[model samples]
Target: MRIARMHLNESPFKPSRLVSSHVSKYVDKLNLYHVEELEAEFLKKLSSYTKLPRESISLYPGSSEALIALVRFCRSRALKLVSIWPSFHGFVEFANMEGVGVDFVYLTPESFELDLAKLTAVGSRSKALYLANPNNPTSNILFQDKDTLDFLSSRFGLVIVDEAYFEFSGYTAADGVLDYDNLVVVRTFSKAFSLAGARVGYVLTNQELSEEIGRYTALFSVSTTSLASALGALEDIDYMMEIVKKVIELREELKRDVEKLGLYALNSKTNFLFIKTPTLGRVLARSLSEKGIKIRAYNDRLIENYIRVSVSSREDNLRFTEALAALLRERSTVG
Candidate 1:
C-alpha cells in the first residue's frame, strides 16, 4: 500500500539534473563555515532572475524563516499583524507565540474573495499586512486588482505578500517592491522548483527595507548546498516551467473528476485544490489515509468540511478519485 502524499503542496517531480549536479559539487565543502564566492554567485543569479537590484534581495534558509524575521521586526516596532483567516496557519501561530497582536479578516465563504473594504477598515497605518496572494487552503488569488493592492499598500504601515506559489499563479508583487518602499514580496524554491528539501527562499523589497530586515536575519543563514540548488534551479528555468505546466494540467483534470463525483472543487491557481467535501474533512482524510492516500484536513470551524489535496502524478490522482468515490458510495448506502 503506497501512500499518495498529497497533503503538503510539494512538487510531484524531482529537481532538475542541474540542481543535483550543482549540489554535488558543494558536498565536500560542508566542512567550511561559509562559501562566500558561491553565495555571491547565487545572489547575482537571483537578482537577475527577479529583475530586481541585488540590494533589494535577501536570502534565507526558507521563506518561513524570512517570515519569522518579519514578524519579529513587527514586534520590535509594536506593529500589529493583519491577515485573512484560514491562511498559512504557521505564520499566524508564530505571531501569537511572539505575542504580536493579530487581526484576521475572513474571506467570503461563498466565493473565497477578500472583502478589501473590510480589510482596509480593519487595517491601519499602524499595522502590518501579510497576505498569501493565491491563498492557501482556498487555491484562489485574493488580490487580483492592482488598484486595490495599491490602496492597501498605502493604507498599511508595512505590507508583506507571500508569493510561495508565484510560479504556478503567474502573478507577483515583486515589481511593487520598487514602487512601495514598505512592500516586501517573499518567494521560495520549495514549490515549483522541487527544492523543498534544500530550504531556499528570498525576500524582495526596497533597498532600504531590505537592509533593515537584513539586520534581523542571521549571517550566512542559507548554507552552501542550498545556495547551489537554488542557483541551478534558476539556471534551468525551462525545466521548472515544464513541471508547472504538467502540474497545472493535472490539477484541472483532478478538479473535474472530483466535481463529477459530486464534490465541489474550487478553481485553483496553485498546484492544489480546495474541495468542499460531503462529510467532515477529518473523516474523509482519515478514510483516505487508511486506504494509503493522504490530504490536508482543516480543523478550523469556519472550513472544517474543506480538504486541500496536492496535484500528483496521474496514477496517484486516479487512486485518490477512486478511493473518494468508494467512500462516498459507502456513505450513501449506509445513509
Candidate 2:
C-alpha cells in the first residue's frame, strides 16, 4: 500500500520539465573554463538581487555544508556556539555532531520573541550565536527589533542568520555585513528557487572569513550543475516572485484553515506554517495520516506538540486540509 505523506514544512515543490526553460539561454552561455566570470556573474546577480556587497558572498554546495563550515570555523577560533531555541534544529544538532557544546537561550512561545536581555547575559561567555531570520518552526524573525539586532551585532563574535526563507519574508540582515565582520548570512536555492536538487547555497560575510572558510574546504564545494542552474534560477526573478506571492497568499489562507480547527498558527513569513496542536503534535499528525495526509511534528521539551507544514500549490494545499479536516471531524464526533 502506498503510504500517504505530506511534508508540512518549507521545501521546494517539484518543478515541471519546463521549470528550467525560463533560463535556458543564460545557462547555455556558461563556459566552464572562464571560472572568474562564473563567480563574478553569480555575485553580480546576487548583489543585484539582494543589494549585498558583491565581495561578501561565498558559494557552497548547499546550506548544510555552508552551515557546517561556519560552525566549524567558530569552534576552531575557540568560540562557543550560542543559539536561540526553536530556530533550526541543525544549529544544535551540528554543534553536538561536531562534538562541541552550544548554549541555547529558549524564547518564550507566548511572546514568540527573542529575549535579548537574557541572551546578553549568556552571550559574552559564548562565542557565536545562530538564528534563522524567520526561524524554522515558529517563523518568528525579529532582527528589526533594535534590541535584538543591536545586542547581536555589538557583542557576539558571530551571528549566523539563516535566511533560507527570505524570499517569503522580504527582509534581510545582510546590510549589517558591511558594518560588522561578525555578521554571517546563510542562504540556499532550496526553498525559493525550486532548486533543492541543485544543491546550491551561499554564506555571506566579509572577504577575510570567506577566504578562511574556503581555505581548508573541498576543491569543488558546489558542482557545475548547481552553478549552471543557480545562474538560471537568478535570471527568473519574475517567475520566482510570482510563486512567492502565491505562497504568501496561501500561507494566510492556510492560517485561516488551521484556526478553524481550533488551532492557531504562528504568524509566518515563510511558505510554511508552524501550528500548535492539542496533542503531542503527532497525535494530530497521525490522525491526518490515517486520512491520507502527512505533516511534521516536533518533540521539544520547550514546545511540545508543534508541527511544521510545507506550503504547496492550491491543489496540494486543499488536499492537505481535506485530510486534516476529516481527522478533526472524526475527533469531534468521537468526543
Candidate 3:
C-alpha cells in the first residue's frame, strides 16, 4: 500500500546533500552543547540568507519554540492577543498555556481573505497581532503591501508575522522590521529546505525586541547538529529553490484538479491547497484514508467540511488526484 502524507504540509523531498554531509561532521560533538561561537557563526549565515542584520536574528529549536517563547514574553506584559480564526494554532495554544486569550477575527466566508479593517480594529486594542503569511489551514495570504504595511506602521502593538511558508509564497514582511519597531517576523527551514526533523528556526526583529524575546529561549535550545544542518541548508539555497519551484508547479496543478471536483479551493500562495468540502468532508477524508492517502480535515464550526492538502511530488499528487476523483465520482453515483 502507498501512503500519501499530506496532513502536516511538509515537503516530501529530502534535505540537500550538504545537510547530511555537514551534519556528519558534528557526529563526534553530540555530547557537547551548541557553543557560543558555533551559534554566532550560524547567525551570520542566517543573516546573509535573510538579508537581516546579525543583531536582529535569534535562533530556536524550531519555529514552534520561538512562537511559545514570544507568547510567553507578551503574556508577561499582560498583553491580550489578536489573530485570525483557523490560522496556525501553535501560538494560540501557547498563549492559552500562558493564561492569555486571543480575540479572533474570522476571514471572509467565501474568499478566506483577512478583513484588514476588522483586524485593524481588534489588533489596535490587543497587545500583539499574530498572522501566518500564506496562512495555515486556509493557505491564503494577507496582502503584504498596503494594508499590512499600514498595520505594522501603526501603534497596534507588536505584530508577529509567521512566515514559515515564505520560501513557497515569495511574499514576506521581514523587510518591514527595519521600519516597524513592533514587528517580529519568524521563519523556519522546515518546509522548503526539508529540515523538519532538524527543528531549526529563527526570529527577526530589531535589537531591543530580539533581546526581549531572547530571554525566553533556553540556553542551547538549538542543538549543535541542528545549527550545522541549518547552515548547510542555507549553503544549498539553489537546491531548495529548485524543489520549491517544482512544488509550486505541482501545487497549481493540484488546485486545478481539486476545483474540477466541484469543491472550492482557495487561491493559495503556499505549498498547500485548502478546499472547502462542506457536507462530505468526513466522508471524503475517510474514503481517501481507506485508499492509503492522508490529508487534513476540519470539523470545526467555522471551517466545517474543509481539507488542507500538501503539494507532494508529481507521482504522489497524481495518485491523490486520481483517488479523490474516484471518491467524488462514487458519491455522485450513490446519489
Best by lDDT: 1
Q: Rate the local accuracy (lDDT) of all candidates.
A: 0.90, 0.76, 0.84
State which candidate, 1 or 3, has the greater TM-score. 1
lDDT of 3: 0.84
- When summed lDDT is taken over every stretch of 10 residues in candidate 2, the lowest stretch is 10-19
lDDT of 3 by residue, 127-207 (tens): 687889879988988776856666555846788889999998898888878878888999998999999999998999998
lDDT tens string, model 2, 1-335?
A: 34344463545455433446633634554455335666677779988887777778888888888888887888889888888887788777877888888778888656568876777787763478888888887876656654566678777878888999888888888777777778888998888777888888898888888788766357766755567678877877877887788778888987898898788788888878888866677787777677666777766766676877888766667777777777778777888
Error of 3 at 272 (Å): 0.5
Q: Which of candidates 1 and 2 reaches a greater lDDT? A: 1
User: How would the candidate models be sorted by TM-score, starting from the highest?
Assistant: 1, 3, 2
Cα-based TM-score, every candidate:
0.97, 0.90, 0.95
Runs off by more than 4 Å, candidate 1: none
Q: List the residue pairs that clash in candidate 1.
A: none
Clashing residue pairs in candidate 2 (N, C-alpha, C atoms within 3 angstroms): 8-308, 8-309, 8-310, 9-309, 9-310, 280-305, 281-305
**For residues 1-335, could you state the per-residue lDDT of candidate 1 as single tens digits?**
78898999999999999998898999999999799888888889888889998999999889988998899888877788998876899789878877776788888876888887788678788899888989897999987667867887888999999999999999888878888878999999999999999999899999988888877779988989899899889899999999999999999999999999989988899999999997999999999999999999988888898999999999999999999999999999999
lDDT measured at residue 307 in model 1 versus the true structure, 0 to 100: 95
